[model samples]
Target: MTRREAGLTLVLMDRLRTQRLPRLQAMHARVTAGDCLDAHDLRYLCVSLEETQRMKSPSIDTREAIRAVLARLYHEITTQALSNEQARFRHAAH
Candidate 1:
C-alpha cells in the first residue's frame, strides 16, 4: 500500500475503534442481553465489518492482522446474536 493508502486506512481504523466499535459493542451487549436488534443495527455492523476488512495498510502482514482482529470481533457479535435468538426461541417453545 502507498503512503496515502496507509494514512487513509489508519484514519478509517481510528474511526472504527473510536466510533463504530463502541456502538457495535453496545449493540452486541444489548443483543446478548435479549434486547432486539433492528435492521439498521445489523446493517451498520455488516457495513462496518466489510469496510474494516477492505482497509489496506502499508504492511501486508499488519493489514492482515488488523483485519483478522476486526473480523473476529464481528464474528463474535454475530455468534452472540445467534445464540440469543436460539435461546429466545427455545424459551418460547417451552
Candidate 2:
C-alpha cells in the first residue's frame, strides 16, 4: 500500500515497523511491503532498539517507552510469524 511517508510515496517494509512516526515522516524510503528480514537487518534492529531505548527521555515512563518499542517490533515480527493454518499452508505450498 502506498503511503505519504517522509514526504514520499512509500510502500513500507513490514520488517521496519517504527514507533517514531515523526522520524519516519522525515526519512521513509519506498521498499517492498511485507519484506523479509536477514541476519544483518536483525542486528541493526537490535542495536537501534538499544540505542533508541537509551536515548529515550527520562521524563516519560521507561516501561511505556519500551512497550512502544516492543510493539513496533511485534508489528514487524508478526508480519512473518504465521498463524497455525497459514504456517502449514505455506509449508505445503513451498
Best by TM-score: 1
Q: Give all TM-scores, in the order shown.
A: 0.79, 0.38
Candidate 1 lDDT score relative to the true structure: 0.81
Residue 91, model 2: Cα distance from true site in angstroms: 5.9
Model 2 steric clash pairs: 6-25
Query: Per-residue lDDT for 17-83 in model 1, tens only?
Result: 8998788789878876877667887899878977887788777898788787778778878888888
Off by over 4 Å in 2: 1-32, 61-70, 81-94
| Candidate 1 TM-score to native | 0.79
Clashes of each: 0, 1
- Candidate 1, clashing residue pairs? none
lDDT of each: 0.81, 0.44
